[model samples]
Target: MVAPTTPGTTPTPTNDAPVADAAARLNRLADGYLVTAALHVAAELGVADVLDRGACDAERLAAEVGARPGPLSRVLRLLVAEGVLVEFPDGTFSLTPSGRLLRSDVPGSLRGVVRARGGVYATAAPALAEAVREGGVAFERARGEPFFEHLAQHPAELAAFQASMVDRSARAAADVLAVYDFGRFRRLVDVGGGFGVLLSAILTATSGVSGVLFDRAEVVASARVPEGTEVVAGDFFAGVPAGGDAYLLSWILHDWDDADARRILTRCREAMGPDGTLLVVDAMLPERAADGPAVIRLDVTMLLLATGCERTGREFGELFASAGFTLRRIVPTASPLGLVVLEAVPA
Candidate 1:
């Protein structure tokens, strides 16, 4: 039988019903585990990195990652559905632009995130129901400790977590650098900026901008931040580094409760210059769904995994207002992530 057609309108056959139906079935949310595991494995194995040199059969990639060809080929085919890779009739494969992101050395590499989800993030998924039930973080159910406490216990995992934020910042940085004029700012303090990825990205792009990366002592020690970065180890709850023209936090507030987040922003408010800018880089939990699913999934994941939850534009405005800073502007960046700018003017 032929697929149904509706006049000039294309009768787009939705769902798994084609020759590639078996794999498409796995790709759909019906088999969440299949896609989840496949993403982790492919990202971990550096399939994109390996294939970047040239296309070869599955056996070669498995050899590079120290795995078995039989199993790896099945994984590669899974990604092919998502456009991460492609297989031709001759039996070899190649990279698509989307797949290039998994390469560890790539500019916007998400290899760390890919590896992380299979580990901690995977564990956290099950806690979503618990968190929704209790109205608190479900990290304990996932890691048997609070998010920060777990980070303290597994130093390496925490380090990788920080690095992944930097990896993400590379993409957001390009947008920040392009849209915002940093020439007027003399100093920038990256409050809870993780491994200084956002700070490094912004500073590297803006000449004559000095930076202070404030975080826990352990996190600061682990960040292999690039040049001209001063590491200040302290809790954002206590106080941020002083004398900066700007204070920034990327994906930081979503890791804490509103009261704590407000307290942290208050510190930033106290530290800034009279006309300083405070920038927050992370997803703004939309009042209604955006045209995509990434942010929605990420917001829910934050609800399950951390003490924080993603916020809407108004939610951010309230947080900044409570912290004694005024919400200035909301700039949609080059990436899906948006930037929220709050200003501290003399009262």
Candidate 2:
């Protein structure tokens, strides 16, 4: 009979252990889509919110979420294994730390992101093969239109995407404000600023500085800003309002290809004073794939959603140089989205 190893001692390496571990990892990678689909279903059904009050058995959870007990229970069990939920001996489930993020009322809730990925982006994933074969957005290929055009046509989808952006930006804005000094600039123009949420947050953070929220006519028209901030409507590709000491392109440049990105930057350059600062807040990819899987994932999403791509610092530097701006420095932030504040100035 084989003897069991002591708790504190290392077990003798079996030749099969490493191979088994590798196979497990590979299997997990293969099954990743299942996790995403389950999370989407949970977010859509408000399962997290249902459990927010207290733990509940699968049958009760199903009743509250309007799902069948059998399937819902299985999904919940999967979530339990995934660490998003904790299953008790009595067969009741409660939220885990990660699970709390799905609640709508939470401070940094990712409910919007969950909905967007599952409902909108998931449907576009299969078209990625087509996108690679051709040279356009997979979303365009799947849905018969570009991402924004599709959003414009469908109000529900548009609302969900907007909400997702807000959810993403809300966390990022705080992280940005922590690292970047918005107080240094007098007049800051937020180009392509949606709903002025980030701008409002910035302005609130810095009392001395005023800001302009620039976006589409409809977007700016509905935007609510603090007293010192202004909401302006126009196409950024055409021109931006002049005389701002600082220009912000938050979560903007990643939506287009190099040509379009250059055009947008050119517009900013034209609008910017010689000494004006240009701050671009976007996801920056790391050199090592292991360092930034989330960024790489988003890059794939961009490949499918728009004619855009996430860039490295070198790529961004090249892009800025092409637009007659010299890259100053890329500031890192604490946001989980891996947002980098890229600062530049007109050449």
Each candidate's TM vs. the true structure?
0.85, 0.89
Per-residue accuracy of model 1 over 1-347 as CA lDDT, tens digit each: 23688799765646546537656766586777677788788876677777889998888778888899998899889888878888999888888887888888678788887777766677777776877787667777767788777887887678567666767777777877777777678888888877777777777777988888888888888776777689999888888889987887878888888988888888888887678888787777766776536778777777767768788888888888888877777877656654443343433
Local error of candidate 1 at residue 140 (angstroms) = 2.1
* Candidate lDDT values, in order: 0.76, 0.89
For residues 235-312, could you state the per-residue lDDT of candidate 2 as single tens digits?
998999888999999989999999999999999999988999999999998798789889988888898799898999
Candidate 2 positional error at 345, Å: 1.5
Residue 23 displacement (Å), model 1: 15
The TM-score leader among the candidates is 2
After superposing candidate 1 on the true structure, give the runs of residues whose Cα lies further than 4 Å from its correct spot: 1-27, 273-275, 340-347
